[model samples]
Target chain A: MQIDHSENIVELKNISFAYGGKNVLEDITFNVHKGDYLGIVGPNGGGKTTLLKIIIGLLTPSHGTVHLFGQDICCFNKWSKIGYVPQKATNFDNSFPLTVEEVVTMGRYGKPKNDKIVLQSLKQVEMLEFRNKLIGDLSGGQQQRVFIAKALAGEPEIIFLDEPTVGVDLKTQEQFYRILKDLNKKLKLTLVLISHDIDVIASETTEIACVNKKLIYDNNPENFLRSEKLKKLYGSGVKFVFHTH
Target chain B: MEAVLSLFFIHTNMFDIFQYGFILRGLEAGLIIAVIAPLIGIFLVLRRYSLIADTLSHVSLAGIALGLLLKINPIITALIASISSSIFIEKLRINKKVYGESALSIFLSGSLAIAIVLIGIAKGFNINLFNYLFGSIVTVKQIDVYLIGILGMVVIGLIIFFYKELVYVTFDEESAKVSGINTNFINTLLIVLAALTVSLAIPIVGILLVSALIVLPVVTALQFKKSFKQTILIAEVISIVSVFLGIFVSYYLNLATGGTIVLIALGIFFLSLFF
Candidate 1:
């Protein structure tokens, strides 16, 4: 599961992000290489989502530079290569009148001739059968799948998901992670996932980046489990139980 | 049975009405508004800015009053006023201190106050003011028809060209911005278009009922479980049918044109809820 450093797709150099005068992320650094499943776990209000937003270019870091594909993140214009599934995707208005296929097609907006890609992306998420169904009619887990398909329709090399399992049932969450594993292993797509469930994502992701307003741990999941980082991030009341499938 | 039959035969009566030049011009303007209003309405309803349409309509009424006092084209004056006020409202919405609904309420009340004061200063309400307030299909002029036609073409063209972008922005604005769509420009353009639609629709539906023409059809369409494109198509169909039938009924029954049209759209909405 080790990713070569020379082939890093995302590199952050002393990334520090703040909202107004309040510091959200301070003096953080990390690298995501091709085909790396990097999981970001943090406590509530610990700046996890802000860090993801900074990396995805939704928010600018106040003090540091980001390099995507070895280019300055600000100037990197090939946004089609990086797909984003925002946290709010799960809470979209159920009355919205969009079909699954149309939602997927939104990912292909700036691209040319995406009919085949749209179907392929839907199939990847196993949602091809429900492509014509209204998005509001689908269950929350199914809607999340459609959102992932929307990101995939652009045929992106890297995908970033922000707390995607919120409000989803336990079984569906397991299935969702299985699909992410398949996307990483079969499609060779790099993934950056943010989750509050430290133990669950630690088991699934190859690398774990534990943060509490700063980069605490940036290593493989095994080392993350053995280290004192989890204890530092969350106090003695927090328990870590690793389950193998 | 006879009433139903006469209602059916009202199609011929509609033809007789259309034979007059002024009635024909009114029909032209009414049909164009039927299309443009619902197109703008879909976005407003989706974005939770349906009330903004109502506020802008009242603003257009003040514009019309100013034009009458100045002896100029009311539609042109209304267009200028609506666009200017819409930009101002957008700026207010962007300011962190002012909530969006608060901004809309301020404009809505402020514009109505302006209209009332102007009407009082200009020697009180006249038949012309009544016509502008409740709408008079028989009074539609050739110049109003031309203005509606040009504005209709521009609104329809913009909606068609930016169909996907508009849908994306409407469904999820934050995601659209991350995807590199100029969300601020699209949002401002949508507000401006809504303003243009309100001003142009005033003559056909009146300032009091213009938002109904823009909103009711979309609400009716929402009663069914359909796709976004389907919702828009159904909304347009409902609007067109209501405009034609409402105009015909008003002509034969001697009812107020704007009120009758809005009543028909409301009737259709109730029917949609039932079936």
Candidate 2:
């Protein structure tokens, strides 16, 4: 599962963002090396989602530069190489009429339609059996997996997921992380996952980047747990809940 | 045996109705709109922007007034007005300051006021305006049929061409944008197509009830909960049947054409609830 760290997949330099004249992210700098499983952990209103949006060109930074796959993001048009799974709460209308297979097929938009790719993507997440089922009929965890299959259908080299496990049950969350880890190791796909669950992210991700309107820490997850920065960032109220499994 | 014979004459009389040129043209236009309305409606309803159809239909009223004032074809003027106002409404919504509903409300009331003022200035066109407001399908001219056919094809063609993009954008705008789809352009294109639909439908469905034709069938189809393609097909069927029934019933009963069509659609919607 080892991947070369010689090349950076995403490079953010002095990224700063503001909303209504108030700063949300200030002078943030980081790099996501190739095939790296980067987890971004921050408290509510800490600009985690905004940071992700800037990297994916959903929101332009007030002042900074972003490079994706070595190309400046402003000129970057190869979006097929990047996949995004947004927060499930805001992803779709519950009343929308679309099958699981149809939702995944949207990933192949602008390209020739390929049923094999859609099926393969669904099988990757073990959701092939539900391809014909309505997307709205699925449970929260099942919906998340279908979204993952959607991202995979694009054959993306890197995928950014925002709060993907929110509202998912604990058992399903564990299974979801396992599936994500398997995707990273087996497929060598780069991942940038945002979560508030510190313990699970620290256990699962190869690298951890802490943000509190600043890049407080960006290094190995193990080192992050051992450092005093986690306590300083979240105050003394944060408690570590270890999971046996 | 007598009942069977009477039913045969009734069926023959129904076909014989088309021998009248105006009736034929009215049905022709209604059927075209029946296909076009739900094609645009499915996307609009999914995004909860169904009110935009209402807003644009009212805006077309102002366009019609201007057309009457200038002594030009109101459909052409209404098309210009609705399309331009659609762009304006979309721009206002995208600015993020004005809420989507607020933008629609502003256009709805603002356009209605303008239409009333123009109607007052254009005096002596009350009869024409009444026809436009309530829809006089029997008065649908040959030129209107030609215009509806050509422009209706354009709208349907564009919707089909961007079918995948439209579905993706309507389902999740953010993801579609991340995946390299130009969501803003697709959104504007959708409303403009809606404007085209609303304007073209004016001669048959009238201004006030145009949104019903666009919205009712889709809402009824949504009850089926089928896949996207199947749902659109169901909506089309509902729309076509409603239009056919409305025309036939109104022709015999001497009812308002627009009200008749919408009532039929509403009846179908209520009937779909039981299924």
Candidate 3:
């Protein structure tokens, strides 16, 4: 609950939450500054999703007040400044009959911006051609791209993506991250990504925070491996595999 | 002779229609039901809360039985009983104990049972019971028009203004809750709208027929559009077309109005399966 709130975009101070007599998150404290790319990783039943919910203002902490951009998270009226790409599983409904353009257009809700953000969002993810096709007919890669496009439609300052690469093949996963990196660099968009993949996240994210019911490790990825503290966080017999081409 | 006379019903000629006050009343009632039925139906289909609709309709049937037993305007009593049933269902169908459908089913079966008992309580079943049970196009009234129009506009207005929130919530309720949208109020608002539509349409398309009328249009459109906006647009179109065509066909062929419309809708739904 001792988050530094001086000039950060998101500051969580001593936040704790429990549901139905079971504690999911304990007195966790952290601040995400503007333009910071924070990646979250942890084992199952970890509070990674729970923490993301708190950031998105979905679940209020049992004991702490969240501050966003120098004000309370509850006070932030403008949602366009915070673009979100919920999990791929959450966005796609197989039985739904929707075209990619129609799904993408929903990104325009609640805020007014130029069509550039929409098209650019789609273009960045290489989904511009499939815009006319039904989302139900799309391949996994194209579907993922459409969701990312929709998320970026608002052109927010910070983008929150939860488990963006759950079931896709390794190549598409790599492609997705590469596209995200390009957008982050060219558009200068702050990214907050959550993934269960240890190796990929370790390489791609500028900052890493290992979470399991608490903010166990929050530091730069370069130092993440060397720290005995972080090594302990990942548990025993941890090994990283590297492929040489 | 019945076919020829029934086709005469479709003439709907204002002058000749009112010269025969029965036809005039029938037209008024049909139009009123047409407008309100779809107005209430959209949310029920969207929330996938069809059981409540089914339950309410059955409960409304019991109210109609009371009217038959006492020899009063069954429609008023039907509306009252349906609304009351909906209220009771809403109270117990909270986030605790069992699923929402279970609660709806309990009331649904109870109401249907009560209606059956009432039928037994009276003498030979009134012909009116069949009209309310299935469908009847010969019963529209002028007062029903004003009521349907006013309530229909209010419900549609609320939907349009809050369209985005509704879509967002329907897509993923948890996310909507996190975004600070009031899921509870919106849910109740949707149900209230559904109840109003049920009452409005029950007079023409009886409880069973109206249920199909409400859900069929929405379900059929879902086959063609995944986007909430487009689906709703398609649903309204299908509903209007089926109503108009069913009315015309039923009038000309001496058929049940509700059944004909639902058949037309089912035809469209089957056609979409091929598409």
lDDT of 2 by residue, A69-186 (tens): 9999998998999989997543566768999999999988767789999999999888999998889989889999999999999999999999999889999998899999999989
Give the C-alpha interface root-mean-square deviation per candidate.
1.1, 1.2, 3.2
Overall local distance difference test of candidate 2: 0.90
Preferred candidate (TM-score higher): 1 or 3:
1
lDDT of 3 at B243: 79
Q: Which 10-residue span in candidate 3 chain A carries the lowest summed lDDT?
A: A1-10
The local distance difference test score of each candidate is: 0.88, 0.90, 0.73
Error of 3 at A30 (Å): 0.7
| Best-to-worst lDDT order | 2, 1, 3
Superposed by TM-score, candidate 1 places the C-alpha of residue B14 at a distance from the truth, in angstroms, of: 4.6
- Please say which candidate is ahead in DockQ: 1 or 2: 2
Candidate number achieving the greatest TM-score relative to the actual structure: 2
lDDT of 2 by residue, B67-161 (tens): 99998899999999999999988898888779989989999999999998988887658588888988878658899899999999999999999
For model 1 the local lDDT of residue A7 reads: 93
lDDT of 3 by residue, B1-275 (tens): 36644557656542453565545555666655555555456566656786677778888889989987997777778778877767666667655565788888888888889988889879647678888888775655566556656766776687778766666666656545544577777766666667767876787678897788888888888888556556777877887777777766666566888888889888888988886
DockQ values per model: 0.69, 0.79, 0.36
Clashing pairs in 3: A1-A14, A58-B178, A97-B225, A97-B226, A98-B226, B29-B140, B29-B141
Pairs clashing within candidate 1: none
On DockQ, the candidate that comes out on top is 2
